[model samples]
Target: MSAHDFNPLLDIPVFPASGFAPLADRLKRIFATGNDLLFIQAEALLALEAAASSLGRPGLVAVNVVTSPYGTYFGAWLRRAGADVVDVVAPSGQPVATEAVAQAIEMLGHVDLVAIVHAEAANGALNPLEEVAALARAAGALLVVDAVASAGGHAVDIEGLGIDIAVLGPQKALGGPVGLSLVTVSDRAWAAMQSVPRFSPSLLSLLDIKEAWLDRGRGALPGTPPPLEFHALAAAVDRLEAEGLAARITRHQRAAKASRAGLRALGVEPWVADDDRASALVTAAPVPDGVDASALIDAAAAFGVALGRGFGDIEHRLVRLDHTGGRAAFGPVLANVTAYGAALAALGQVVDIGAGAAAVTAVYGEA
Candidate 1:
């Protein structure tokens, strides 16, 4: 279909006011208005470059690795960017230990950047960034965070977290269309990026994007920006700001609590052992005995509730419930629970439908 013929949601908007301007403004407002924050389309790739540049091309970079699909991709990107990576591994269903990060940095002795994911929706794991940031600072490494899944789902204070670069995507919890991404760069990160050689192509170059954002006043990049994605993102941001970040976070937290409670009542346990490491956006739970997760997900699809199967290695063993974004409400939570229960029942798995619905209702609490 032609761009014009496509639905309003599919149309791309112009930059500055329609595209870059609102994004730039929202980012600036969040990450300290006076600080230099570069707007970029290719956020993940640019973030990798930013991290490499910040470390002064140190021989080794330390990454606090968790069982996340993004970690694998980010590590590959770092290696391609010419940084030797030392991964501090955390097992599946757990957050990376702060001590592991500290030890790795200490052993490396002059690590460049410490890269971490704030929340990994793939495995429903959330890292402890506050402590990790402190560890990075102590080791004299710039802290880069992948906040794509957690940015709008939970509260993120880039400056307060001591993050040098915070990367986010509009797709996940932001309730916006995909393709468009964002990255917030601190002054230090911008300076570091400026000094690094442009190893990336024009679209992926952090330095070029930064220069464009500064020189072009939001319409710096060549070609037109994605208008509908921009408008959707702006509307998402407006809704988030109006609802208040704290309130939105609380809503997600409540949904998560309800989901977990319902799952437990159904004789299912969280895939992640530690409650502290659980993310509000997605919850990974073990499939019941004799139940095939793929079959379960397929069954769910028939009921108009498309549940996500386990990603990567965990496929077939886990089922993931995405409770964040526009789904963070009492009604949606109840609907998801009822639909899931029905799916299980259809699959010959005995589930207490009333129990699951009651758990959600209890969380909503007469609201």
Candidate 2:
């Protein structure tokens, strides 16, 4: 294909800022939320930081559940904002227990906010968001969840879960650009943010976006919106609507199940053994004894299959077999499982590659 023939692909169109509010409305429907939603032209982490900065202030006590690095960052942002944060940290590759969250809330007596990450994609842990949300609501605390990796892969009902502030990045499961993100805010959260007089109006200020864009009729966005990111987001929503959100979620679940089953057959246990606690986006397993994670990943790459490295403290200890976005399909799942087995064998570890492939095939066949 010559550049002349592909000119249409390169020719980009302008994404009008006026269309931002409507897109937000469409996203609200996707999330099934009646609460106010905002589209920030940045990754979900920045939006999450904004939430912590906006909600965290002097006199606000928060119970931050640390399941992954994102949760740790939330606590730091809250502390920087002057809030007294009690971090409930879970063991690596495990979800925070609901009982622990309850205990923290009870001990605090008055928690103004609760923060958590719904899914840590690379860590293989899916937090008990429903139970934790209930705890936060019972404590009369605003709950903020980083659902960047879980939104499309799993069922995320913002209003149903009573998530006071939920942040999402479309780059992961939604297969969209990483430059744009969205957040859902409840009435109570808005009120609490309004009460925080210490928060100044800035790009990361949720209140600033509300006062300037939403309150002012939701016309043009506050800053210059990136055209490519907005257009890609629109395309992603189109694809999502066409393929039913429930179906997309089911595909991810199947991918996870298939990966786990295949890995188990090859004697590689899942990082999180419980299916209920593991993330659907990726399946994580510890690197074999004396096996270098980077070398295994490189070997898998040689076989034309991409494997991800774990993040944070578990970076060198674990390897992630991604089944996210476009890869949540039979072909990719099978390739990932078989390639991983092959890489282990190449590294002198005994593995049943044929058994692993058969296991993956059986999963799809049953489906």
Candidate 3:
């Protein structure tokens, strides 16, 4: 079946009230098998709060801010916690280099923590996590990764990669509800939190949640949780594991290849030129000359394919084609490509629809 052929409902199974036990059991097993860490929200603000309290020396904390658009918020939070922030700025269109991160740590002289976003879906960039992790470890800095866009969409071995804390949300590649997030905290991270001063909102406190889960058990909690979203995330995790993470990554890679090929055939080029630096989840392309991206978005929606708009500073000149979620299916992909080609045509720009479809068909056929 094509990627778009599966029923959305088939992607997540409903768990009855009595089924919570088995579901929780499954989560426990999954965590234990992987890195034996606690799950938390994808928001780095929350993770930093927990990390600050866990590390004790808030003054010694140094955040390695990269090219992520969300770095704006993360930087604010780090400074609020009294961290000495260092912005290792990469160009908006590309990933930050590990050498830059290492240099930042060296300049700081006493680095306590290093935070990096794996894939900034907001801007269509994928950072090199393995290289960053090595630099952080060599510099004796605790590593925290925001893998919200990269988690299931690409390969990430939290423990093997030497990441102290890795955060993920279910919304992007997992094809689940958004509110539920996961954080894999290594023993090193747990120890850091153990030493930190405790100061945070009750609901946002990682210590409180970690203690409850590690001490009492998985089902135990300080207050009511987002049970439905958690259940949905668990179902998403199951689907990912069953399908095989490697295979899922390969599928996304193929889809991205097909999409880029189609766009090229239509005489449009990606905003981010380096193929290796671009993310598989989303591609940012310049709006064809004489075509208004906003108008194209409206026209594509008429065809039932929703494309993400360029965010932040890149808003007007670019349009983001998101291949994440259930829409990664072949049919949805073709629909999006065809609709986009047609939208460009409506704007008086010439495009070869046959060639675009054929490019996608070629990739899908090979897989």
Q: Estimate each model's TM-score.
A: 0.88, 0.96, 0.86
Instruction: Please provide, for model 2 over 1-367, each residue's C-alpha lDDT reduced to its tens digit, 9 standing for 90 to 100.
Output: 7656746446678788678888888888887899998888898889999889888888899999998888899999999888999999999868999999999999989988889999888598999999998998899889899999999999988888889898999998998999999888999999998777654568778999898889999998877888888999999999998888899999999999999999999888888999899999999977987999999999999999988898889899888889999999999999999999999999999989999999999999998
What C-alpha lDDT do the candidate models reach, one value each?
0.72, 0.90, 0.71
Best by TM-score: 2
- Superposed by TM-score, candidate 1 places the C-alpha of residue 110 at a distance from the truth, in angstroms, of 2.3
Residue 205's lDDT within candidate 2 is 88
Error of 2 at 117 (Å): 0.5
1 or 2, greater by lDDT: 2
lDDT of 2: 0.90
lDDT of 1 by residue, 134-183 (tens): 88888777778888889777777887777887887767777765766777
Instruction: Summarize candidate 3's per-residue lDDT along 63-90 as a digit string, tens digits.
Output: 5666766666556566765667887888
lDDT of 2 at 118: 92
RMSD of each: 3.1, 2.0, 5.7
| Residue 176, model 1: Cα distance from true site in angstroms | 1.7
- Candidate 2 C-alpha error for residue 215, in Å: 1.1
Clashing pairs in 1: 12-227, 13-226, 13-227, 16-21
Off by over 4 Å in 1: 1-19, 31-34, 42-60, 216-220, 348-350
